[model samples]
Target: MSTLAIDKRTLRQDTWWLEPMLVVLGLGAFAVYSTWAALQNGNYYAAPYLSPFYSPCLAINCEHVSVPLFGSWYNWSPAILILWIPGGFRLTCYYYRKAYYRSFFWSPPACAVRDAASGYSGETRFPFILQNIHRYFFWASLPILAFLWWDAIIAFNFGGSFGIGLGTLVLIANAALLSLYSFSCHSCRHLCGGGLNSFKTAPGRYKAWGIITKLNEKHMQIAWTSLVWVGLTDVYVRLLAHGVIQDLRFI
Candidate 1:
């Protein structure tokens, strides 16, 4: 029998509820934690700088942004807000697609399944088929990263006022996060080398792509590392804003 067949047999024999349940639990925990953290740091409501940029309409009022954990307070943003959406998107990435589908979608093990069981064989659908959206997201995120880098610069200019002046550590963390997210994207990998049929024909492009592939191979590791560090960077900013964290400057 093939390896996929063995995996399918094992999956069939395994308990289905455990993986799905764990997915729910994990998502729930992250939602709760993120909501609580935002509320605690006064981010649930619009920041002073953000208010002038966008007005709160009745339907999209910021006050409606709250997650129901213990008692539902006006938590500021919905649990499914933009901050949390990225997590869901990343969880569904091509590299993570199989692991997450099995856990969240209860997909059968593809390696063991034969004849249209590899998870890719399906009627094309919207949103679920929206994994292709990452290509757009990859390009879009670059501009956001540029703004983040600018924010870091402003933080330095103000000498870290109102917690806006992020420290060097935070700056480094931000750069690392941007690098990991940008470099690990599937679109970037494809642009690097996946599209090329023959390296000998396009030696220059092939060499450049070869370098990018090395980076892409470690994409998952970079993704997780950057995720953790970016969260910490936000925490640092919040702590400084609230006067709970201090920036140590020398010279």
Candidate 2:
């Protein structure tokens, strides 16, 4: 079995590097925006509307916060407490594993491309071994998704009055997008369909599995859409909270 002795890095003809490079820029920009927004602490709450980045505001300093579970002792942004669940989920996601591995790690940046590293250890190492807990992260994210939905519902309550506003719609859309991304996860598919030997035994599970499978097919698109929408939702709330913009009321 003699292979070609070509010494070049890759024989790919098309622009394979373009995809990974774009991924780098997209994820990098998101990291910058999310970091800045999370640390601001202020301008995350605007009355009936709260930024998705700081929902379930746990700190006493959080404005209009319902829970205040962390209390005043816990200073800094409350987003620090909440973001980690979703962050860990996305970090350990199967799709994201491929994305960052190619873009950030540059390990076989594209199809048929040479790996950046000389050797391969896979995810058996200390930090990479942690990826195995992705299913746990998925479980943890379920409650967070519930909270986001609660936030969207509360956005309709304006000081005890039912009102519809642009911010309310934004929060609703944000929650919906995140729901799509979360439910479309591979872990969710496994939970719905895995470990089943006979689909005839559990028709309900089979139906749910079919639905999740359809969603999973578009997981990448949903993931990116949800990520961008969350950032935008935060910006919308920040502007309104800072008095830079006023909420457009429809009802």
Candidate 3:
């Protein structure tokens, strides 16, 4: 009976569900706000009057802008939204596999409880199996970063005849967000660390890995910061496009 009590305590300690639940709820709220902001800016499709060149849409509210074909006419903002779905999942995703088995899918723990007189059965159930996805997502986000950079350049073109566009500021914000995302990724740290095989053997690779590990140690904070910044980047572009916000130009 005493051994069973100890086993239950261990199981409870390993399966934490609250943290991930909060993260999901928070991200959902942000998604709703971002969508509303995008619609308000006439960015649900495209506005050539707001941005002359590189407009994703040929006409406003046109059927030509299809989600399956081009994925919404608004350029950078939509990209940000798409990236965010996986981004949120990657954050605090380590517990997903564990929580799923212990709390919902599998219910009872996989290991058998035994007294000291008998041998203990090891835990056969897998924990953190879903976290393997983070590796793939880390690599996938890199190209998205490049696309965002390109969009930032186009966003700078101001619609009016004379004034320089506010796209540069938007570009800078996107760059910052990309930096945060790249730095905090788990797979990026492994890549920086010199892949799986040479991570410990190569001296130079080890040094790089150490640096990235240090950054990844603060992954939670960086994740939240990047998440908020990316959302703000979308809103900023939308506001500028809609003439709700003005970008100040020095030169």
Q: What are the runs in model 2 whose C-alpha is more than 4 Å off? A: 1-5
Clashes of each: 7, 0, 2
Best by lDDT: 2
Q: What's the CA error at residue 81 for candidate 3, in Å?
A: 9.9
Clashing pairs in 2: none
If scored against the real structure, what TM-score would every candidate get? 0.62, 0.96, 0.56
Model 3 / residue 241 / CA error / Å: 2.6
Selected candidate, larger TM-score, 1 vs 2: 2
Off by over 4 Å in 3: 1-25, 35-128, 153-167, 194-201
Instruction: Write one digit per residue (lDDT tens) for candidate 1, span 215-250.
Output: 788876776566556555655655555667566654
How big is the positional error of residue 194 in model 1, measured in Å on the Cα after superposition?
A: 1.8
Question: Which RMSD values do the candidates have, in order?
Answer: 8.3, 1.6, 8.2
lDDT of each: 0.52, 0.90, 0.51
Give the per-residue Cα lDDT of candidate 3 at 184.
61
| Model 1 alpha-carbon drift over 4 Å, by segment | 1-31, 35-92, 108-123, 160-166
- Give the distance in Å from residue 1's predicted Cα in candidate 2 to where it truly belongs: 11
